[model samples]
Target: PAASEGLPRPIAGIGRPVTAQEIAGWDVDVRGDGEGLPPGRGSVKEGEELFVQQCASCHGDFGEGLERWPALIGGRGSLNTDQPRRTVGSFWPYAPPVFDYIRRAMPYATPMSLSNEQAYALTAYVLHLNELLPEDAELDAEKLKSIRMPNRDGFVPEARPDTPDEACMSSCRQGRPVAVTMDSRRFVQPGSGSGFSEPQ
Candidate 1:
């Protein structure tokens, strides 16, 4: 008996072409400054209830962050410190993108499972938790896009006009090594996993 073994050829372009509807379905990206937002409405009150059932397990009942999950509400003025808590209220720069992030990935146990209205509600709720939005604020594309982030001006964009690709080839300087601090202040929750971490 002879074994059938030989070099395997690469298979490319074997799948069917994507339809317009399918592409539209998956291309649900919401942009900053209020573009690409779906039509829906959400309120802080609606968000509070949904947050408890769907989000509280990891984010906690108050968005204080469960163990090392991440504190979503506070950290208003700690960005200047060496170790910043870096929550939505403290670090995020825009509002529309907040909706995008939540709608895309949240409730770790289930991502992209929330309806547009639910996503809007959750977005409003997280903002309400941070005290950025009023308790009765109604969130929509226009209003959400207009909300200002606390550290909106905290970032300074890099403009290396003087430095070119050719300059980098000859006189580029290496970056200094960064200091790593392992703080013991962090505690783990009962069922929270460790090792790899995901996007905030």
Candidate 2:
């Protein structure tokens, strides 16, 4: 008899393979173009109610945000200011991701607890708070994708050499590079020849 005949199979039967249903449950991501959005619809009014119940504690009743929490509304036209207030209306370039974020991680204390319809409603209510949607508006995957964000055109392709789109190893600059250096002797103490002085 072969020595291998007495040994157990090489495959370890510790855990079972993941089922398709499990994969579907974990693959709940909505794309920017509205792909993968679950079949559901939610009205702004419904969303308002859901937001008040599930989101108002941290995000405030109108999405202004409580202490230390981020605001979801306003900040429109403030991106160019010294104290820029980045919010959903001022910074987000797409709308579908909003629903995706709310669905996956929201209400802080209990994430992924809300149903798809509830997520949609909360998204609609947030849009309403941003003044992007009417109080009577209803949001589904189709309408959500159609609604353009205020900063839809705000993002541009990165031009830096370190970025993937413009990565380069040599000759990246348009002109001669200038070297910036500080005088090390200036940092030395007057009585100490080589030792550097501590900053006051």
Candidate 3:
């Protein structure tokens, strides 16, 4: 006999299996099309208050980022620069991801204690600081995901062919070899016979 046949129908997933009530856990994803947002709302002002108390020590007052810390605003278009660039407004593509990241990891010392209301408020404040939304904007779960970033269109799917083809290597632009004009002897000592020479 099959092992599952002898078990209870509900436990065995046979006919009319038992079901549990779908507990409405906090799965507030808030997609870009304004989905999964809770009914609550918040503004930048309230976010600033929360930020000053919970944040700012590490993130900076203007979101400029403290010593070796993450900046929360600005840097609209400097991704290609040699220096480090940051800001939720510039680097991040989706607002929902920002909210998700913040909810998952934020306030440095403390993690995941901010209520949903406070998270929405802080999200609004960051958006306001980055000029993505107005300071008085009341960010609810619906509107938060719709906010787009400056570099949204900057990325594209990688279209380059994979390796081992050896077709991607460029031409060696350094033209044909020429006579060495510089004296190698002068560069080194008069009688240095060792294979490798040490830098002065």
Best by lDDT: 2
Ranking by lDDT: 2, 1, 3
Judge candidate 2 at residue 192 and give its lDDT: 62
Q: Which ten residues in a row have the lowest lDDT in candidate 3?
A: 17-26
Off by over 4 Å in 3: 1-23, 26-34, 162-164, 167-200
lDDT over C-alpha atoms for residue 200 of model 3: 44
Task: Give a tens-digit lDDT track for model 3, residues 122-168.
Answer: 88888888998887788887677667778777678997786556553
Q: What is the C-alpha lDDT profile of model 1 across 75-96, one tens digit per residue?
A: 8888888877788899988888
Show model 2 residue runs off by greater than 4 Å: 1-18, 162-200
> Please, what is the TM-score per model?
0.70, 0.72, 0.66
The backbone clash count of each candidate, in order, is 0, 0, 0
- Quote model 2's TM-score: 0.72
Model 2 gets an lDDT of 0.89
Q: lDDT for each of the candidates?
A: 0.85, 0.89, 0.75
Per-residue lDDT of 25-118 in model 2, one digit per residue for the tens? 9998999888989999998999999898888999999999999799998888889999888898999999999999999988788898989999
Worst 10-residue lDDT window for candidate 2 reads 191-200
**Best-to-worst ranking by TM-score:** 2, 1, 3
